[model samples]
Target: MNQNRVQASEVAPRAGLADISILANASLTSVTGTDMTSNAQGSYDLALKYSGTGLASVGVADKKVLVYALPAELQGKVVGGATVDIDANLLPITPGDIPGVSLLFGALGTAIDGVDKLVAIPAVKAAFDSLSTIQNLGAYQETLPATVSPDGKTISVDFTQGFGKYVHQAYVALFDTLRDTIAAIDVKNPIAAIPVKLLQEASADLFAIIDAIADGTSDILDNALNANLLGSMNGTLHTTVSDPGVASATVKAGAINNALISADVLTATEQEGEAVTLNFPTTAVNPIENYDVAAPVITQPVAGQTQVAGQVTLTQPIPDGTTFEAVVTLPDGSTKNVPLAADGTFVVDTGSLVDGQTISAKVVATNGTYTKDSPITTATVTAAPIENPIADYNVATPSVAPLTAGDPEITGQVTLNQPIPLGTTFEAVATLPDGSQLTGTVESDGTFKSAGVDQLAAGQTVTNG
Candidate 1:
């Protein structure tokens, strides 16, 4: 075979130890340092520990392997990635870690950060299942970490010292991302006219937090932060023993950030933070009729609050389709992937939706978590028509007078506006010149008629004719 033709080299022989140092991101086992040799094809032995943590109650449980750039010596010649064949007993299975690794050796501390796959879904589910109670009912507060530097000075920040720093930062990122994402889920447009007071307070809070970080202390949080964000999009509320359900459990709430909440008019015609309407093209792939999206119409400003008029109309003519879509551009560097039902301009059967009731619909696209509650319509919702006997009785048909007994007729038809039952009886009791009562049988069809009466009471022109 040609030397250039690549082939799996056969195992040559065993050798001495090589330069290797394995540090566990989580709690480690027996070995913190070890050595391995090129077993014919650059294979090495590694002794590692579960030395660190991903998060406190949240560590990688599975046996993970953090592959690194071949320790400088084997850098250029090393292949794209490495594959480790473990002695089945050493790593029977993968751990519940973010990065499922057994042996972790980084050129530096940053190597752990590069470990992409932290933990698998099964592991995450298993691990999080242990904290079901707290996970289901906890508010994600922003993280407050200790600082080491003062203002107006450059300092070498060592992020590698404490494991809690990594975990805390991760928690903050996770919490904030989740909180904001979920808050923006229920409707299309929310937080258009944010309270100026809220923005100022948030800015103050950030300033205080920065001061703390610069002065080497815990960071500060502001009350301006949306306290109800966790519960807004139905997050922090679950009834099962599983997480990573993502669909049934994982919820995004709000994306309210400093960037999204700004208020300085820059352009002549455009206000700095004006809420703009999203018009879709009339020639759309889906029309508005197909969707069941209905939002509350915003009215004039209220006494103490600025009314935000939020309406989601289809730029594209949504025919009788079911799926609604919009490529919304938010104030922040984010996109609104709204695949919500295209309910034109009004919220659903919203009991009139007038009582300061906010209109919120399910968001369809990925990462939709906020409720778009606009100004409520003034229309009221009355109770639907009911089935009651009293109503039916009081509302009767037009009244009619009963037939008289002196009326005369031979073969005339009669009719009653009211319905007559099958057994109703009537008779044609006529009289002849002989003074005997004229008899005529009534038909089964409830009709009676007579034909013979030539001469009768001539002086009495009115002989019951």
Candidate 2:
């Protein structure tokens, strides 16, 4: 049973009920209507009421309501008719409205079937031909403002300005055909075919319309006469437009309190007209002090020195209201600060340092704007050399002889009145006239000698003690 057939340019009219006028009387179980117009004829009358009962031979077909083009395979299919009670007021389209069957013949004016009256009017003309095929798909042609609510039981279908231009022309033609089909695939033998629940419902409706257009909410559709569109449900519609003025006043109230702290208080009815509830103070304060000081180690006048007096020990330990100073730097390049003394010791009187010069120290420390410095430590003054005093010493009289007779010999020569600094050593006392006290060690230039002097009684006299 392949049937299908419906195209006569898909039949039209429904818009404002095109010049309607149905009026059947003769007690035909009801069917009333008056001069309804529209197509600019404008008289808009649509009430088609009728209560059950054998609508008396249904006869009175006057000013057209002929509608018939359904067949896009009987849309939401379900067409069997013969009940008849009737009730049409129409006007409530919205699914990207336009070519309409006045809401599927006003919801099939209830069980209607004056004898197969076009069998459920082809499922209400296949539900307005599926809302004129989704208002002409692709870049979705337009048409979407269907409001009706004042107690008429809500219809509201504002595709927020044509759903943000049909989701930005369907995400720019689906990412430019997925970047030209992944740049003509073959990335090392690549293969692809994904629909994964329609790309996760188009990535959760494009991140909930980018988090409701970054918080100014209203689900995006700022109406420049509509076309910003993009509501896909989540909290329906909102964005009545307002965000553009921050170019650059240098932007910083702590970067707008760190970008609205955590946002959520801008009420004044979401502000566009009056509702202004701002209140920002989320507590938490202190955050800008900053500090650093570590570099003070010197520890006193050490490294090869000859004279440096008084305090200068710093292996760093002055941190409670810190204050040290000590500079120095002198080998003629003059410099001197010198204060320290709260434990990191320091004293600098170098007494006009001389004798081999060279000073160099460094200690710094401060602490309110933090300061640091301590790596120079040098020293060299050398001053301890002066000696000249040996007034008299010329002992050279020791001649006791007896060698081959009894074995006794003593000989000597020592003289140093003044010139001593070459490995000096002098100790010679010899009173050998039977009195003996001898020691020898004065040689470099002054001499002293003794040859086993034990038998020294020859003439018994060798004195020079």
Candidate 3:
């Protein structure tokens, strides 16, 4: 067959999150090509740009194709079972697309026409002592050659396409000896280098599947390549630094996630800023959370208030007149009592919250006093108090800067132990299921006093804010 290399860039949009660049060129280094004497090479190299920040850019190569980096916001709460998409962009085509088996054989020289060459391949030590020198010779003069593929139709050849008519007769003779030797190996590692020296002989065939064009062929390669992409690791490996002095920088190796990892990989051995190497084996799995849906977006905090109020107002998907009540459960297990309007909203008085608290929320459909037994949708919210002057607490119209009557913001009050150094920031903080976090701005004052940063991520437990 004849064709052109499918343009991965032009096809990127159809593939979505999967990396198109890596699938076309990368190979694994640890894997030896099926041939020891042919034009085989180890795994490919795939490079990706650092597109995210802080936590999101932790480059972890889980496989030649599998790459992973956590998001900054999803940090800490990430668990081991989190699921990520292995982009389908690398999978090969379907069986129907090709004339026969799912494997695609393209325009390169084929078994019927190409010259063949054989090279000694490393064998498992178990059979090494008994292996005959006669079996070791790659020549077909003394022994018969094995067919390129099991179907008995394919012929193997190197990319260079050397040799003459003598090669034809040599192939049939050498094929048998190589086949016998390969059959002699343990079946458990059929694909391993020591057993499938058949692959070294068949490298040309495998290459075709990656480089050819067919309906499902590229998709098959896309899927296979995607399985090893870096972002698929699903578990975490963590390391921590002790008492790193304030002035002394202490760095520890970041966590590693290795699920879906089929091969060993390279990583940074030292801390964040240091240059190093991490030789990973086949077992590292990264910990992550498989959110069933797009993570609920965090709404911007109402203006004026330093803490974002723990509240939400969603329009009913079914239509009008539906109302729900919200019961806020503090990290301490105490629940808040509140009404959800027919417009679909509930709010927590974040202004009265305490520091360093964790919270989560659950909602139940209700009409004032009678509550329904339906499943409750949940969210998380965390709010901490600030030390702004009580004088700021006149509570007129519940006005927070940029405030809206519908979703009023709750400002926290806090006193800095010292004047914030020049260029230093004083931010508001809120407590939610993830953890208590520093929030908004203080406008150059060491006294934090803004409402913008105290946004609420959906599904988080709501506390005072």
After the best TM-score superposition of candidate 1, give how far the Cα of residue 350 lies from its true spot, in angstroms: 9.6
List TM-scores for all candidates, in order.
0.16, 0.20, 0.16
Better of 1 and 2 by TM-score: 2
lDDT of 3: 0.29
Model 3 per-residue lDDT tens digits across residues 345-403 = 55665444344444455555432233333333343433434545543333212112332
Regions of candidate 2 where Cα sits further than 4 Å from its true position:
1-323, 327-336, 339-349, 352-365, 369-408, 411-420, 423-435, 438-447, 450-465
Give per-residue CA lDDT, model 2, range 264-346, as digits (tens).
21111011111111111232111111223333344344434433443445543333334667787666686778686655555
**Candidate 1 at 4: error in angstroms?**
17
Task: Please give the lDDT score at residue 158 for candidate 2.
Answer: 25
lDDT of each: 0.26, 0.33, 0.29
Q: Please state the error at residue 330 of candidate 2 in Å.
A: 15
| Candidate 1 residue runs with Cα over 4 Å from true position | 1-340, 343-371, 378-411, 414-465
